[model samples]
Target: MLLKGKTVMVTGGSSGIGQAIAIGAAREGADVAFSYWGSDEGALKTKEAILETGQKALAISGDVALPESAISFVQETVEVLGKVDVFVSNAGICPFHSFLDMPAEIFERTMRVNLHGAYYMVQAAANQMVAQKTGGSIIAISSISALVGGEYQTHYTPTKAGLLSLMQSTAIALGKHNIRCNAILPGTIETEINRDDLADASKRSYMEARTPLGRLGKPEDLVGPAVFLASDMSQYVTGASLLVDGGMFVNLQ
Candidate 1:
């Protein structure tokens, strides 16, 4: 039980990586709270799973792109779970679009949800941790897209890169307060968000072949790394980007 009696709040926990992390934290003995923009069924399932682990769970409705929603989400988590020891800024969107003729709305929406949303959520969570005067952990669900270029993700890549940058800067800013901020760069986890992109059998097989691990990632694969960051295991680690891509990023010649 790495986080016994502690509280964790994650954004976009209705499904995918976010939902997995939320449940993983609960299993480690932390009270889990997640803010979701959609999927009532997913939210209920997350809550139930957490409770089954004998930990408290809270499901909040929020759009991380909005500053107030971020604030409210953090506030409610504290109101219910007392204090936040770990905060996961995982709410994001990536609408794949070509760079040659990207729609302004898609680009704007992607940035707002991925980058701006992280900014607000991290700020709100950091403020709460600072006020608590207790050191905490902040994890951003960045992507391998941050470290590499994506032809169809010109708009999406920048937002992920922005999240990685945000973690680095925030780490420096919040280090004095003992708040550790880090980013996790997953290569290509099989999630609904990118199901369409990988639907092409050729694309899927190519991606699998490109990775040194010879397989795609799963949402559950991130649990261990996230737990390490959230617990005392990473007490002295901060401002770092942990690549959980199963060797995909390093396979390029």
Candidate 2:
């Protein structure tokens, strides 16, 4: 039990990679609390799975796009599950839109949810950790898009890239408090956000061929990496971006 007697809070944990991370933490003996935007059904399912592991679970419904909501969520987590030992800022949105067709409203909304929301969550978590005087870990779920540009992700990729910079800054600012911050850059994982894109045979084949592993990554593929960052195994690691992209980032061809 890498996280025995710990408490973990995850955002956007109702489904996909976030869901997997929440469940994985619970299995490692960490009580889990997660936030969901609007999916009661999905949130309930994730809560049930975490409870099945014999770890307490709290499912909070709120919009991370609002700073107040993010602050409130963290406060609620502390009130229920005690101090958060690990905070995963995984709530984000990636909408495909060609640069020429992108609307200003859409772009702003993306930044609000992906970058600003993460900022609030990280700030709140760090404050709580400092208050408790217990060092903690903060994991930001970024993406390969942050490394390389995407044709339809001009608006989306920047937010992901911003996360890396945010983590670095937080790592430096919070190190004295013993709080570590890192980013997890996942490859083209098969998730609800990218399901339609991956379903296209041509795009799917292109992605698989480009990836050295010859397959698109699954949500489960990220569980181990996330757990490593959250646990004491990575006590000395901070301000780093761990890529879990199945070698796609290195395949130049």
Candidate 3:
């Protein structure tokens, strides 16, 4: 009951890490809402799960990459939930290609969603948190790619790296207002997005062998840290990143 009576929003909540964070919040006794740009079916399923946990849920449909969409989502969620106690900017895309040969559009689109979208969400949510004067938490789902450069992942790496800096800057500015901002850099979480990309045998084996944990990360593995960041458990913590990469960053081989 760490988050009892609190309200939270998770973008990309239909699946993957976003879905996991939303469910985790509900289980911790928080009212939840989440945004999904894709399938309504997945969003509906997540909604049902949230309801079963006895938490209210608002399944919003929108693209986080668009400023208007991000603003609209924040406005609508506040209308329904009264106030947002936590916001997790989890929506992103990673389509890898050689840096020299990558298409301009793909790179631009990735920057739009992964970096710009997060900026807007933080602005929207932070504004609300300031108005409420109740303080809140903001967690951005970053990646290990930001820390370690990898071949063919140039676009993704910079955006994820931007998230870490964004978290630090926001945490400093919002500290006096009692709003906390942090990033969770997870390594190789077992999500459909990654699954699709790992169809190549070489990529699959590389990630597995590189991770010291001897296994790929699960979406559920992020639950504890998400809850911690969203709850008072991290009240004294801000301007930091909790790297949940199972030693991926330290394996330097």
Task: Tell me how many clashing residue pairs each candidate has.
Answer: 0, 0, 0
Write out the backbone clash pairs for model 3.
none
The ten-residue window of minimal lDDT in model 1 covers: 89-98
Stretches off by above 4 angstroms in model 1 are: none
**What tens-digit string does per-residue lDDT give for candidate 3 at 150-189?**
7878988999999999999999999999999999999999
Worst 10 residues of 3 by lDDT: 191-200
* Tens digit per residue, CA lDDT, model 1, 53-99: 99999999878888899889988988988998999999888888889
TM-score of each: 0.98, 0.99, 0.97
On lDDT, who's better, 2 or 3? Answer: 2
Please, what's the RMSD in Å of model 1?
Answer: 0.7
Measured with C-alpha atoms, the lDDT of residue 180 in candidate 1 is 99
lDDT of 2 by residue, 122-218 (tens): 9998999999998999999999888999888888899999999999999999999999999999999999999988889998999899999999999
